[model samples]
Target: MAFPRNGLTSAAPADTRLKLKIARKWTSAEGIVAIDLTASDGAPLPAFTAGSHIDLFLPGGFTRQYSLRNDPRERHRYAIGVLREPGGRGGSAYVHDRLNVGDLIDTSRPRNAFELDETAPFSLLLAGGIGVTPILAMAYRLSSLGRDFEFHYCARSADRLAFRDEIEASAFAGKVRFHLDDGPEVQRLSLDRLLAYRPAGAHLYACGPSGFLDAVVSRAKPGWPADAVHREYFANAAPKAQSDQPFRITLASTGRSFDVASGRSIVEVLADNGIDIPVSCEQGICGTCVTRVVSGEPDHRDLVLTDRQRADHMTLCCSRALSAELILDL
Candidate 1:
């Protein structure tokens, strides 16, 4: 490797963990509402790409991830939509019923698990319900580049559709289509026809509920290349493992080993042994506790890791070991 003659110049990400306040809030749909967040200190916020999400540090010590819906080119404000999930674990309820405009909030810098492939010749963006948040951002970027792209939004009804006004007034308004289940029979999103078309070097992105994303992924699997398809999930309801057994966690650096009981979790056992790994969303939805596997097989139970990525890493917070002894890159 050769160093640059200019003595290595690079830009570090600006601090986004600043004191943030909700500058504005409005109802976007029947159950969804949008909020605009700005730094209270009046400093520029961190730059974010399309499909990025930020962690909201809310009351009751709850942290949740919400996608950025506003234009990525702007640094002054970030917009996100929240769907009140009555069955949720209290995060959405807080945003809908308690959290308010002008209230100071803590937010992490944007992180993207579903990234847009900018070099693609054409793109297809699909959003189901509130999943339109990140997809809308991509639409903004695509329209700015003068690129060829199509945006499809699927919802049970027009009332369930968020950001309809913004979409109608956008530069790519002609490229947008709305699929409502309650509308005409011909208007509902037909996966049979939608997944049948494949443009050369075209990419597809989907986000929404788990069932919605699963439908899109399964339908496009046969036609779209695996690398060309991207999807993101807001929450995961992974089933409990029925075949869990006792296993060993061996730290690679210290050669320390800990016995993990079948009834307990890896994170609990690790913390008892004086080793703490960052943990968030212990339900295996968040990728915060993912750890590298040096040796042994993992009975991967996380929602974030792909089949290829499961070969070397596992989420320590919820995942368990398949082998009797597993070595971790601690």
Candidate 2:
């Protein structure tokens, strides 16, 4: 997986799978579990950026994307923190209840849409609840680069704060602040005051629930440049696209045409026709299924893509075409 140009690794194999063994697993917080996975064959795992996440193929045919929480420079093992979501679609529940150390698991190579900007003069890291997974990695990278950064973590209570001890013990501990709803008055998060300081050319990165990210981005606006504010949403914020009209997609390569019916994604329609596109986190949170749009307007639904990128690419898993027909560079 050597790259002479861009610093990126390729797909795992023809199967698109990386077999790994759980090196360690432990409870990180009240409802969070930290896991470390190493290559099953004992080789160095592929490198990953700070905000990268891998798709974990779990029992019962469930696939979930988990953020890498360990330092990006470490290749001995990949670390991820999972918050037990009783109401989720069962991935976290299986991890907390059945997964154990030494268990062999299947996963995809690391992929990152939430990449860190190492060139920024200053960084503002914000995390709410489990959203800290990516922010924690960013903090590790920033600290290693000796880049100035301020980190703020918010949780409902002190018990829910994940990696409190580990983060505080870090070299950049002095740059971090934790806000708990039940903690002291000064420790409570005040978004207004927290976002008031707008350093020139400073970049802000945030991840968490849709509401939390929405608040942070909405508040940062008019103060921070649109391109300078980066975020990764844990859940898809946009509701299921309401348009039920069927659309046509033309492949630029074979000059083939297919009609994507309502309620079915472009990826599904293509696969049914014996065409497959690599995909993960079908909810549009990950860019695994992003495809270039040769022509036609797209009804973008993904949370990761900006208004600008929507003009050229679309996540086939969720995004659909606005025009009657879309020409895609398949």
Candidate 3:
């Protein structure tokens, strides 16, 4: 029920699940649905920054996260764009099929893992597909600050690009460039073209599909400074992790215990046992799965917690206990 210290909030306890009523739904291109929403009760909600995402608890026990695409300063409502991924595990299907205007849905409060660094001299943004959601916010902020920046957005085509007009109308539009897969190869962004502008003080941020991210990362390695490159993958990274090893989790509050099999995560195990713990992006970026360690060390595999946070609290969703037994603040 408590909010995250890093300015993230969840639905109120009594309202553990807030109803998201669609105020408007429009297709950005051919298939992508840009959903704008307001709480059904029409009450004020917690504010969020760019790169913040919310957990939508859908039917069939599915929880999918979508980044906030609208200006973060607007506290009255939330907006997100969902691409109908037929290959996806039904998350996008429900968004495009069952959801509609006036439909009430359960959703989590805003939580952010991808955030912009205000101190950076300039920003170079790369967006692919729906990955543009968070970068869109950074563009807004950087524009307001009058920071020098450039946005290279690549999508299959113009129709698939979300908020094309708005992004162009933004104060940062002069620096914005669009690349369509259907266009000639020279028009698309390549390491060769982007690296030319990678000045000494510029910071590069990229987000998109794994293939696109990999391409960007490979291209950036040559000339970009180590600290200047930052990337966010909307999907989980490759699981180089070994097979699961069963472990024991001891809860300090009630002295309860549970067994976390190698096949499942601690968060999933706890949730199955009716334990109430807040979590989003169960893959690890959201930091919603953070819990204090009572005893023993953690394996610390999640991306949410920093080196300092891992020395203090650990993220239980993707991280596991490294020691024989571990105690946590359940």
Q: Which pairs clash (backbone N, Cα, C closer than 3 Å) in model 3? A: 29-159
lDDT of each: 0.81, 0.84, 0.75
TM-score of each: 0.89, 0.93, 0.81
* Rank ordering of all candidates by TM-score, starting from the highest: 2, 1, 3
User: Whole-model lDDT for model 2 versus the true structure?
Assistant: 0.84
Report the number of the highest-lDDT candidate: 2
lDDT of 2 by residue, 104-165 (tens): 99988889999899999999999999999899999999999999999999998888889999
Tens digit of per-residue lDDT, candidate 1, span 1-330: 000011111111125355689999889999888999998987789899998877777667666778898889999998999888877678887888887888998877877666888878899999999889999999999888888999999999888889999899988999999998895533699987999979999999988888988889899988898778888776665576646899999999999899999878888898787776766556565466788999998988777776777889898877898789999999
Q: Is candidate 2 or candidate 3 better by TM-score?
A: 2
- Worst 10 contiguous positions by lDDT, candidate 2: 1-10
Kindly report which residue stretches of model 3 are placed more than 4 angstroms away from their true locations once superposed: 1-14, 41-43, 184-186, 196-201, 221-228, 248-259, 269-275, 291-314, 321-330
lDDT of 3: 0.75
